[model samples]
Target: MPAIIYVPFGVYIVTDTVEIPVSSRVIGQAWPQIMATGSKFVDPLKPRVAVRVGLPGQVGVVKIQNMIITVKGATAGAIMMEWNIHESGQGSAGLWDTHFRVGGAAGTDLTVKDCPKLSGKVNPNCVAASLMLHLTPDSSSYFKNV
Candidate 1:
């Protein structure tokens, strides 16, 4: 038989770090601010989000958090957002994760077990995803290296 990858939950993450110039730090924070809105998060039990503030004058924690967004079936998708706040004197970096797991046929969902692949490089900032859906050749795909 073929190598069947049966997963209870499927997750695809696109992590990228970002840097906001002191002149326009607000732009970098737009993503999280938008998610904070009530209409953004679909199911609280699924794609969870957590942020780490790194100020220009402050410190940044290299921590990973999943707010958890609810995935319906084998083809569910969710967007988890995080923020790293920094002081005006400097910029900050954060690891953003985007996971989606929705499988078909019998058994559990198609999760990225065994090969918990790491897509795209730790982005410079979340603004990259803010503009486009799939990455281009020059653009960063969620499954490429940094």
Candidate 2:
């Protein structure tokens, strides 16, 4: 049976990837954040996903909406989200009003004081992620107002 997961408005720190299974509907109130942190997501060459939607070759309904995804501390290799679910129908799988925020904000340790753009040099510590989102070849999704 399909399940509805409701996340309240708050900050959630995740040291590892959060996987969303098939036939699941995730709704967040007031734009809850799923923040990634830790050494596991620091290698740019071997990037890892912070949020994974469904397993490989999974065909079903997976909906995620009203959420904010971000990275904290040193996460240069973090891919904010990976979509791998093949939709069961035209509008079965999708994300709405969901957004991604990397760094340069509060609680991210990447403030403007730490990573100034006019500094004439890039600060490695301000590197938030390698990629924002990854849509696998086999995945099909309908995203609106993301």
**Which one is best on TM-score?**
2
The total number of steric clashes, by the backbone 3 Å criterion, in model 1 comes to 35
Best by lDDT, which number?
A: 2
Measured with C-alpha atoms, the lDDT of residue 42 in candidate 2 is: 91
The lDDT per prediction is: 0.25, 0.92
| Displacement of the residue 136 alpha carbon in candidate 2, Å | 0.3
Model 2: clashing residue pairs? none
Cα RMSD of all models vs. native, in order, equals: 16.8, 1.0
Give lDDT tens digits, candidate 1, residues 9-101: 333222222222222222112112112212222333353232112332433323222222222222112332333333222222322342322
Candidate 2 minimal-lDDT segment of 10 residues = 113-122
Q: Which digits, one per residue and each the tens of the lDDT, describe model 2 over residues 1-146?
A: 88999999999999999999999999999999999999989999999999999988989999999999999977999999999999999999999999999887799988887677888877777888898889999999999998
Runs of candidate 1 with Cα error greater than 4 angstroms are 1-59, 65-77, 87-92, 96-146
What lDDT score is found at residue 84 in candidate 2?
98
**Model 2 accuracy (lDDT, Cα):** 0.92
